[model samples]
Target chain A: MTEPPFRRVVVIGAGLMGTSVALALRRFGVEVLLEDADPGNLRVAVSLGAGVPVTPGDAPRAEQADLVVVGVPPAALGTVIADALARFPSAVVTDLGSVKAAALADTRAHAPAGAGLDRYVGGHPMAGSEQSGPLAARADLFDGRAWAVTPHADSRPDAVAAVERLARTCGALPVQLSPGEHDEAVALVSHLPQVASTVVAGLLTTAAEGHLVLAGQGLRDVTRIAGGDPDLWTQILSANAEPVARLLHEAADNLHRVAHTLEKRDAAEAGLADLRNSLERGATGVRRLPGKHGAQPEAFSAVPVLLPDQPGELARLFADVGAAGVNIEDVRIDHSPNTPAGLVELWVHQDTVPALLEALAHHGWDVHG
Target chain B: MTEPPFRRVVVIGAGLMGTSVALALRRFGVEVLLEDADPGNLRVAVSLGAGVPVTPGDAPRAEQADLVVVGVPPAALGTVIADALARFPSAVVTDLGSVKAAALADTRAHAPAGAGLDRYVGGHPMAGSEQSGPLAARADLFDGRAWAVTPHADSRPDAVAAVERLARTCGALPVQLSPGEHDEAVALVSHLPQVASTVVAGLLTTAAEGHLVLAGQGLRDVTRIAGGDPDLWTQILSANAEPVARLLHEAADNLHRVAHTLEKRDAAEAGLADLRNSLERGATGVRRLPGKHGAQPEAFSAVPVLLPDQPGELARLFADVGAAGVNIEDVRIDHSPNTPAGLVELWVHQDTVPALLEALAHHGWDVHG
Candidate 1:
């Protein structure tokens, strides 16, 4: 077996991201030393086989590690990165904070002189779940995900390569981008969506009970992210405030314009045209989202099957698909709040739709176009 | 079996809603006469066994029907209801339009002298798919759903009972409210979400390609409703413009406040508090949404299982779940783009979690808390 790129890695946090990285590295037979200020978090990470917990006397071992990964809250990222760099003089360091530019700026402003600045690279792995803590960590958390690596002008090329290798070992695709570019991109795609979802869902709090009874899949889908942990989201949004705030302001303007036009009595034609434009634009945006395997969005024919609300029904349906030897690209379950039956939409490549449909029907599944 | 509440039902407009109603009525052995201005739609509904098409020669038969259900576009709903009331003089009439107040007002203004105004009740079934047309109709479309029934002060009590009976026969729960109250309720629960989703998705059209590569479930969920049919949405929005516009305006004010606070660098503490409040409100709103069987939201523990991307894997998992003898309250499949494994979260009652987990583990499934 080849030597692992991050052989002696010290992870200075035992949160979900830190433990996940440790687990991924350990899977590749790398030696990982886990550290966290919280004893309980460290214990949980160690018990999960994420890594060996760093003891009080293991300072020398941590200093001698080949790489140190900082995975703390955004507010504490700079101090943690600086400390990691100062203590682990011989090791290169990287961070997995969501907001890149702010963390990089913080590290630069606070790092002690001769702290090996060139050895540090900024990384933000665009992967997470609403769930948190070491218990939620998975070795495959970063698999097939985009790990944004932001290297400064003065950074050593070897240091950047080490982080790239770390991402690769975690089964992630490394994408090179500047800190500003990274922040801007994520602000539009991630932060803005979170804010918008929260605002929309907030309105529901005042909704009448009768109103909520009329709720459908559209309302559920649009507000799913509002269930995220508020404390963590607040930290994330605060760290990337400027860009997120700007995008949200623009959205607010659009909302006001649409509302005004809708309320107008004489501008019915104009109001409709405006609403249609927004809807069409939204359609175009969703269409541009990359489909499975990072491919351009292509229309996948959905063959919806009505499945009984019984145990093993979904399994039976999948078994039928397996018997047909067709690959199921994606599947979605649409169940009404109190309904016993669900419409399972199996999304497949268009060319294979006919064969799959026939096979499913032959298996006595209630298939619908 | 006893005769259906309405033995002879005339369904106007052979679209998804109209056809689905006809199908449900027919299941109860009712004679249904389907009418649509479009010959092709009428043909499809008839071929689907939804109802017998209403021919020009069958005008007298349609007029003499026990009940007439007007299911036309919002723009044409008022005129259609009036026409149905005029033709079917003895029969009670109701409409299944999304917006009730406008349709009721239009009917009141346009119905000819001696028209059975007291027999007319307005309804809006709180069930639909993004898909439209007769081909999209399902026999159980309204089954186990809330069907809003708006009866005016002058509406006859017997007429109200007939509409309630119609809802019950179609397997929907009739929720009685004023037309104004119904419009206001839906504006908050349904219309606001649609507008917010559309606006947020519209912002993505201008996003960099790099931005979309990081898109995850949150982004997908928040934008799902943006894929709805633009034309139909325009009509729905226009019909209930006042209530929808007012609600959206309030949402816009909230957005502005959040944005302003987030953009203020000097007010970090206040900004975070504001952001947290929004998120907290969102959480409260989601908690109020009814769980399965129309019960108050109950916390269910999710047992996540890692399943291979192969076809039969889900089937095997479901089979294992069945063997556990536990009812799965809900299931969510979280698949990363291009990943060969997916995390399937099985939500069951908190009390059933331990047994379900132990059984799955015994079956060699990779179960996680």
Candidate 2:
């Protein structure tokens, strides 16, 4: 096999991210020493074949590790990172934390003077689920996802390289940025949306049950991220307080402006133009996002098909589409309760539509449009 | 095959919703005469087999239509409904519009004295796409979706029944509500989320290009609806101003509160609890949404499997799973550009997981978790 990214690595937490990292590294034949404060998490990760549990007797192995990864909770990131830097003096130390600059500041405040602070870097794999803990961890959790590597001014070049290498070894693309820039970027892309979704979902709590029965896919998509762990998000938002709070204020102001516009729209039709302009800006902003693998979203067209609510229908559908040699760029299934049939939207490059349609028709599949 | 729900139907606007209704009606062998101010849209809908074009010679057919469905832009709903009531004097009139109360009020104000106002009802199929116009029309657009059949105080019981029959005939569940209650319900479920998504997406206008490259699925989901037609949304929001504005202000207050809590978090750790509580409320609200078929979301377990980025792999995977006699409730494919592989998450009932796992392993499919 190819040489491992590192000879030996020590992971300080055995939670979802930690265990997943360990499992990914193990795939590359790296020797990983796993440790967690909770014995239960450690045992679960070990049973999953993520890594061998680190014993007190493995002090030398810990010290000799070429890389040390601290994958703890947001509240504990700095302390664990500092501890790892000091413990594995010869190794590069990195962390998995959402907020970068705060973790760096905390590390600087906690690390002992003359310790290898230059060997530290920060990382956040832009991939996770609503579910948490070791049982939810998977070796491919980071596959084809963005892994941000945020390096501070004093971070050593070799240390930054080591973190990037770790990202690649885990099947992720490392996007490099400074800690401050990383914080600002995530504030716009992650934290602000989190709060917006949270506020929208929080309002749903007051809605009558009969009203919520009218809920559709749009509301579900808008609120899905709001279902994330409260304590964890609280820690993350707190760590990135300044930037996130600024965006939240901006968003709130925009919402209030919309409300005022709607309120005035009846008296003057011109206010409708202002409302339309605001929505137009949102449409333009949505267009700015890089589509899958950086392609433009227009590169694909979605063909929705109606599928019978049965075991083998989807299998047959896929088999027919495959026989046509059409590659499905993506698939989205919309199934509501008590519906005898579900809608599956197959996204493919526009150029392949005719082939897909022919194959679908040949197989007697119900193409919606 | 079976008797049509109505002997004859006239659709007044051949846009997305209107044409979709016409197409759905055509499936039941109903005689449909479609009209549109835009010749291009009318031609396209007619070419797609949605319905026959209404020529000047077809005036008698339209006047004789048993049902008149006004599927126009939000701003035109009122005038058209009033006009349809006058034109098809003996026919029951219904409309496909998002907001209900304003449409009813508009029709009431515009209808000629002694006209058939009692024959009017309002309907909204709670299913749509960001894309618009006749080219996007589909016969199954409202299949298995909630179609709110809202009636004003003056609406005849037979009129309400006719509208609900239209909904059922289009393969949708007809939900009954008063016009005012429908507005309030949509304000919470649809309008609120639309503005929240728009406001959040609106902020992305000022984001740096590099920052936008870091965007992930969470941001995408949160902003998807913001890509909808601004003119249409502006009209929808304005027509339902009171309730939407109220909800907007509530959401804004929540956002401001979260921002304040975050700002005070560094000064006092107690502020973190407030933040956590806010997030917890969001999580609880999300849980209140009825899952597939109105079931709880937890009824299905998601099994994520890695897929190679090549034709036929998905077919092989689905074929393998189907051979195991397992029913797939839903499928979500997450594929990023430049990635050599994708992740397909198959949501199945919990009891079928073992058989799925066994089939996956036997077929050499890579299961993520």
User: Which candidate number maximizes TM-score?
Assistant: 2
**Cα-based RMSD of candidate 1:** 9.3
Interface RMSD values, listed in order for every candidate: 8.3, 8.6
True-vs-predicted CA distance for residue A166, candidate 2, Å: 1.9
Give the Cα lDDT of each candidate.
0.82, 0.86
The sequence of per-residue lDDT tens digits that candidate 1 reaches over residues A1-369 is 987767699998989999999989988889999988876567557756778877778877777899999999888999999888888888889999989998988998889778889999999888887667775778899998889999988789999999999899999989899899899998888888887888888888888756788776778778877877788888888888889888988999888988887888456587789878877887777767775633733656788887654433555677789889888876665435653245678888888888998898798888754
lDDT of 2 at B166: 95
List fnat, each candidate.
Answer: 0.63, 0.70
> Against the true structure, candidate 2 has what lDDT?
0.86
lDDT over C-alpha atoms for residue A62 of model 2: 78
- Candidate 2 per-residue lDDT, tens place, A1-369, comes to 677789999998988899899989989889999999986566557756778877889998779999999989988988888888888889999999999988998999899888889999899998877667776778899997889999888889999999999999999989998889889999999999998998888988998758887888899999999989998899899999999999999999989999999888867878988899999999999988877634567778999888764433555676689889999887655445553345678899989999999998888888895
**Which runs in model 2 stand beyond 4 Å of their true positions?**
A292-369, B293-369
Candidate 1, pairs of clashing residues: A315-B315
**Which residue pairs in candidate 2 have backbone atoms (N, alpha carbon, C) closer than 3 angstroms, thus clashing?**
A292-B337, A293-B337, A336-B293, A337-B292, A337-B293, A338-B293
